[model samples]
Target: MKIDNEPDIADFDAALLLVMDAIWSARNVSLAARRLHRSQSTISASLNRLRELLKDQVFVWDGRQMNPTALTEQLMPQVSDIIASMRALIWRAHGGAEHAHRRFVIATSSYVTALFSAGLLTRVADEMPGVSLDFIATAPNSWTKSVLPDIDLFIVPTNVARTRGLHTARLYQDAYVCIGARDNAQLVADMAPDDFLGLRHVGFSSVPRLTASHEASHWHALGITPNYVMQTPEYLSLPAIVAATDTVAIVPGRLAQAAMRDFALKAVRPPVPVPDLEIVMVWKPAQNDDPVHAWLRGALVDLAMAFDA
Candidate 1:
């Protein structure tokens, strides 16, 4: 059932169409490649396929840039609506993960990752099967769009989130506690400040703590130097590592409780007077209005509630 002057869309690739749109807007193979996070060769291959299928010179290159052919200009609006329709159809199919078939990026610290990733994974499996989560331990430079365009969420402390002036919601505030193997539970539990500081500590830190922040400075002000026998940039791994050995750690209460179930670990009140750490989920200004993203944020808030009272 071919119309007189219309080409069959069956021959056209849906993904290639998206490439066309990117190229049309960017008007340069290299620029479009950067925008799409693809290699120039990849984009060129799609453009070549598009030209062969459409039987039209989509874009003719001028000395400085590529200019769209007349037919290409005419097809732009119709193709754009089609792309939108395809995206909407996909979202409707899943309905739960409104941004289904899409990948979302999150930049966070190891501590926050340890706190929320498990809950988020469980929720995603049950509710948003079509959605996926990518957790990066290094915090993105949210100040610049070009620097980290793919970043969808930023898990940061309340203070840092406040400074961004971006849309953010507080997750939870977890107080610091002393954690240690149950075999040596007596060493940490009911220990005095002097004894707490003297235990062989297993330190856990991510990139954010490389240069001491206010919290570290506060610890130093009290002349509390943890006798760290081992230090690693792994937060979740700390539980298993410390649980397997005799080392103790001054860590968040939530992590300690979680580790208790899997490993023979125990949490005790830190005698050195620890501060409560408040974590927040920061929405990249650009993705703040996305319905699925907003829904995900709500789910995250719910997950945070499960961490502690």
Candidate 2:
């Protein structure tokens, strides 16, 4: 394909650019093949064609990994731009989401999955049958620049989104609620601040301290610390732990609501007012103008609004 206005550079095509981009992003032929959903042999053939057309060794295996050559490094930025533009054009020409087919990898917590996955899946199945989502567990430091490119999106709290300078859109707002065993008498409807602090706590430690601190800002303002007897990375694990012990955990209101149905849990309003949790969808700015990404973002925002309704 002749990118830009040059007529003599027609040796490349859309497929070649896609192969180059996948290989450049993955650095492994097999991984690139998987990303493109093509056989490894097909990817190798495309790579060979790319090398021949460009008259340069695009990538070289340096014992441990495949390294992009200088020419490839210089050309990748333009190649990526071309690919993105081509995708946007195709999306508009092929009727947008109805015809779009790709698996999106989203890094998120189980809490988000529980809150939004079902509705999202149903929507995708109905409106965009060719689209699929893979929700992967996120880590405390998953917002780093190095990790942003591997996934299409991140559903995280506002605090976590600030760690990286990426594009973000608010999904929903929720508040913290204190949860304890359903049979626990300490979980009174109008439990006092002192009474709430008296019980041991279970903390979700998968995110940065900022999120935890924000959740417990009221206690911090009052110069008090909840007795934290346990800490776990997964939020879904807290219900079982809290149900078995006298410890109470501060979790999102929706999480508490969902947990109460599965486990013998009771959620009560926190004694002190806590900050609202603003869950947002985060993505790389590089994908800001891509039509398919924009459509997906719009769909997610719509679903989140409907969920709140």
Candidate 3:
């Protein structure tokens, strides 16, 4: 193989700039260390390395604090501009779900992540072979603002997607079911509305407080408040937790199905009827006709429709 003149990136950890920026702004080793959540010793070490690299004492203690040298002042704006330009380049070139590599990013609930993992992974393996996937979180109530303008797809509640004026198409219709440990003595085939309310529950909290929890907000409308034993932001963790405890939780039917098959958990229809959880995939108009996005969307829609069967 022919030798290449490109410099080795291993020695040039750009992360040094992060420390440099902190040190430059804070103007003190101790203060910079605190602001960057690093130890004073670490900041000092970087300062030493930076001095060696630039052949200048970037900062020197002058009676009180470490003051930036003349060279340091000159380097600041140039370094700042370089970092900003790099970030802008990365953001502008590949802002959506599809990366230069065949990787795709999907923004959804963790429950959705678990439920779709096997099927989606299988499809990618069989069809898109070398492709990779990333699942970003969809915040509880702020699904639209968070998922849109960044991701290629938004798998979220249909009405929420529509209300936000996102370009949306239905994926599947589902409903909530109460899930509990298989060994729970109180769990039975039929649970009354009061019984549902009385049962100690584990909650799926997408954000802080009850507002982010769909199950909690829906129940609140019915004048029902669960005795939440644990409120977890991660939905995948709920199955293992519920399987080991007597706490019951209202989860989407498909999510309950996936968990029941995997864990020692049981599910029963909630006494109070809930509106069908019509999940949809929302995207920008720009991706409407994009080929890669279309293929991924088609695969997802097909997988979701299979859930219905």
Q: TM-score for each prediction?
A: 0.61, 0.64, 0.62
Task: Give the whole-model CA lDDT for all candidates, comma-separated.
Answer: 0.72, 0.78, 0.72
Model 1 TM-score on a 0 to 1 scale: 0.61
Model 3, position 11, has a per-residue lDDT of 59
User: In model 3, where do residues sit more than 4 Å from their true spots?
Assistant: 1-101, 140-147, 162-165
Q: What is the lDDT of residue 101 in candidate 2?
A: 87
- Model 1 residue runs over 4 Å out of place are 1-99, 140-146, 160-162, 207-215
Compared with the true structure, what per-residue lDDT tens digits does model 2 show for residues 1-309? 557744355566779889998888889999999999999999999999888888888988888667899998778755655566566666767778666788888888887887778888887787678888899996646456677678998888777566445656667888888899989887788877887777888888655454354565556776877778777777878888999988889888888888888899888888776778888777786776677676577677777787667
> Candidate 3: how large is its RMSD?
19.3
Clashing pairs in model 3? none
lDDT by residue for model 1 over 166-197, one digit each (tens)? 55566678787777788885465566877777
In model 2, the Cα lDDT at residue 222 comes to: 69
Model 2 ranges with Cα > 4 A deviation:
1-94, 163-165, 207-222
- The CA lDDT at 50 in model 2 is 85
Q: Any residue pairs clashing in model 1, and if so which?
A: none
Better candidate number, 1 or 3, judged by TM-score: 3
RMSD of each: 16.4, 13.3, 19.3
Q: Top TM-score: which candidate number? A: 2
Model 2 weakest 10-residue run by lDDT: 206-215
